[model samples]
Target: MDQPGLATAATQLCGISHPVFQAGMAGIACPELAAAVSETGGLGHLGALRLPPAALARQIAETRALTDRPFGINLVHRGGPAMFEHLLAIAIKARPRAISLFYGDFARVIPRIRAAGIVAMVQVGSVAEARKAVADGADMLIAQGVEAGGHLRGQVGLMALVPAVVDVAGGRPVLAAGAITDPRVVRAALALGAAGVWCGTVFAAARESNAHPAYRQRLVEADTDMPRYRRGLSYGWPWGTPHRAIPGRGGLNPWRLMGGGLRRGDKSALAGRLSLYAGQGVGQIHDSLPAAEIVARLVAGLRTGSDSPPSPQGQEA
Candidate 1:
């Protein structure tokens, strides 16, 4: 937790020791995973997109019990204004270190978040979105490149998108998101002017994540090109919006058969049909490790070979 050399303004803003942020993969990132990362000095996040009020509150309490260190909750604003407001109310009452928001307009809610003494973070896909988030009074911005897994926010790749967003961040810490699967990539993100990194795919396979065993196996077996970005047709989500997922046998994903009916921790065969959301860097990840070890390896590159990398067998150190 005393990794001062790896600290960035973004990490400082979140009060975490390292600049690694575990992406709030809705229905995937669990309290255990978030707590482990936070305890290890990186920022862990509870994905609150699919949770009910009671579940979200319970998760907040569970995370608190696991670690006294700071953690955050992630909510998707585009889900619905009323639901967003309801979740925001719960988040403000629970008062996590920060709340990271994605999709829709952040301006309408950043004020209340800041007023509640919570750091406001917005994830944007394009430079225009970055400017809007900055103007909306966001404390931090996550530049999500098209190479990222799950729902894509921007069509630009990480290499071209990060610096552009950084330039327009209005001095707010900007975190690079996409295929941040290894420490070397983390270092490259910093070189691109990103204050930190927000990672999702790699962490979704963490030992403690809520990702089903089938999904984890798919990630381990996946190649860089296995994931394909397609319109959100199966889910009850808007048809125009695109999301990335690894196809199952015969290039078919079971999620296409169910619409908004899946829940986390469901161990049935239907659980195997859950969309395997992952980044292009899935090839580099081959094993499930503790969230803390993953955090250690991700920050190891910041030392520039001065320190030995974490000894995780399946992943690139």
Candidate 2:
């Protein structure tokens, strides 16, 4: 069987051979994982949200050292305008193939990215956000549904959100994200007019990822009961936005525990108790294979129908 022909905006925007993208997962995304995906003909993303300017530069350099293939940098949009300027400065120096922005406006940075000959991709969780991103000159729009892990902006599921964003984007390319762990979903995204798919949880278990062993194991052992709300963990995100993750022992339901009366002390306590950070698709993950191997399997899975269940082996802590 041949790989499914599911091309979208990613192909034209970033020159990636495949429409599959490795979402920029904070803490786990690194040069090794990004470069490996790029080498395998998919778009790889490096999360620069927590890195200092110097560290971001070093990571970009490191990725370049591994492969000259096209890769992108993810910038959390809420980090203020200065963060954009700083990221732009580094992007100018690194000259990445693409730059993805999420959780903030892209008006100021889009032009700079385009001026630097880099494609600008914006991640949007709502129809309003998608239209705004297009108006702001984003070359590609990632329609991230609420089913996605990490910081979600709205409650729309991928099945409905992808088509909505695609319609709002006009002629622009749209990438579908959220709980897309199966090839059939990949096919569905394309059918919904998405040019590609951006996956985060699928690669969290990759060997090149920096996720803690315990975290990876939790993802593998995840069940339908795994929590995917923001109130469970504390990472200074006061927005109370919903995020997906596997719930561990001592995990408190932010809603039930806080009971709408949150205090500074409560925030502190919750931060320490909850594991925080992960996607609902965690249950689909099985092992910590090399980035290359993960990509190969995804490509293979798309090409041939494999009845074998996903491996349940857990990585060592």
Candidate 3:
């Protein structure tokens, strides 16, 4: 099939060729993966959660080295305003195309991001939050549904949440997240008034991603029911935050796996025990491919029918 020419408000605002976006999933969404997606005409995002200042700077530099296309970095408000300020400062210095914020009231930092000529994208789960984000001067908004992987913010599903967010976005572009794995879901997001789609689970399995080989294989072998969402599935961050991940080998308790000095990004035996954060759409992915190919597939999905994307800008949570 011919690749779709998806030039919507999102693509226009983000200065990208297509509206497809690879979600910045922490641990798995690395610089290599982001650059590959950006190279393929989609907007790629580097995950910056919990990274030290120097590390975040290096990743930004690395992504820039790979591709000159517009890309963004995902930031969370977990570390308090002071911590967010420090991360934001590093991102501003890099001058990326956009900076996506989530998890807390980022209103205070939005102006600074925009002042640096970076697009301030906020991820929200509810209509109220969407309104707040828009009022806070966000250039765009991401509507996250509960079906999404990683730390979730929405209690509603994608089908109902997209339109609700769109209604309160006040003309800002709204990208739909959660269970966004295939072309069908992409089309649905557009139909529901989203300017584009922000995806995580599918991209996590890409060859360029930082996901472990076994984790990538598990995604290929998984079905919709394979992933389970629970509070405190892994260490770090505030307690009671829900995240979805496939159980480790033998279904060991995630907390127990986190013990024994298992460092983050472990690819050995420790890797097998850590939960593979993924969305409910795991069943739709059957193979591991390059990040460019994954972007191609989603871009093709935008042309599955005669549907056209709405005029608006976009985000991920």
Candidate 4:
């Protein structure tokens, strides 16, 4: 396995060259970053969160121009029905190779996507959810563990969740997400029956990501056991969704200043106050590099366990 070929079903189901996935990280997974991953023989995904309709269209067009390889976009299905409709229209117009939905009535949405001849996948945190998704005509399932960054739906760890989901899925392809930045972890997930790996925090720290400088730097310097939190930042974001991220430390106070979000003035400034979402696997990220290099390193890491330290060009890890 020196070349670490695609040994999982994800490569064929998703029409990609590798079994690695770049998690759609909302405002962070920009077009350049997504395209970079696609160019490197892995599936790239644009995070379709908080982006305007026109902006989302532009992002899709831009990414398409970069690479003709099949890619995807992630959309949150838990929002208002009206919002979902509007976003769904935009998504159908973009015509991505695949669409992954999280946190909503996927049963209802899957049909609409299938009508458009698009492969639809659901991100689920439990075996029940996985079973429901497959029954509802989902093409694939992403088993998201609690260690995932951003909004998480359940409390199961990747170590225990993958096999259970796989068993319940009953031959349906399952991708394991959450804290899978390490190559060894990738190998383990595959061993546990995952066909691929969904990664976010590490990609957010990549050079092509749109993460704020402070946020990216925080990920690099973070620890695996640095008292992680399961609450989302209470700035202007919806209050009920649970997210796993590192609290601000050092000079970076990630907590919004008291009454800071009250000012609707500069939305840009408002975005800066929110905490950086990170998975426990962040400790494995030592340097920020291009998306392709990151994918290569992860793939190589899965193929060969090099004892050398990670270099700026992450492929050497």
- Which one wins on TM-score? 1
- Write model 3 residue lDDT over 75-174, tens digit each, in one string: 9876666776788889988999989988888878899999988989998888889989998999999999989877788688889989999888888889
- lDDT of residue 253 for candidate 3: 53
**Clash list (residue pairs), candidate 4:** none
TM-score for candidate 1, please give it.
0.91
lDDT of 2 by residue, 209-303 (tens): 76655555555566545745654434544545556654435545443322121112334444324554566666656666776666655554444
Backbone clash total for model 4 is 0
The TM-score, computed over Cα atoms with residue i paired to residue i, of candidate 2 is 0.84
User: lDDT for each of the candidates?
Assistant: 0.82, 0.72, 0.80, 0.77
Off by over 4 Å in 4: 1-4, 232-236, 250-273, 305-317
Q: What is the per-residue lDDT of model 4 for residues 265-299, given as tens digits with 9 covering 90 to 100? A: 33444334545577888878887777777788778
Q: Please, what is the TM-score per model?
A: 0.91, 0.84, 0.90, 0.88
Task: Rank candidates, TM-score, best first.
Answer: 1, 3, 4, 2
In angstroms, the error of model 2 at 96 is 0.5
The local lDDT score (0 to 100) that residue 174 gets in candidate 2 is: 89
lDDT (tens digit, per residue) of candidate 1 on 1-317:
55554768987888888888999878887899999999988889999986888899999999999999999999996567777888889998999999999988877789989999999999999989999999899999999999888888889999999999989987889999998887778878998999988999898878888877766777777888887776656454677677777654434765643322233466656545655667888887878878877787788777666445444335453
Residue pairs clashing in model 2 are: 8-195
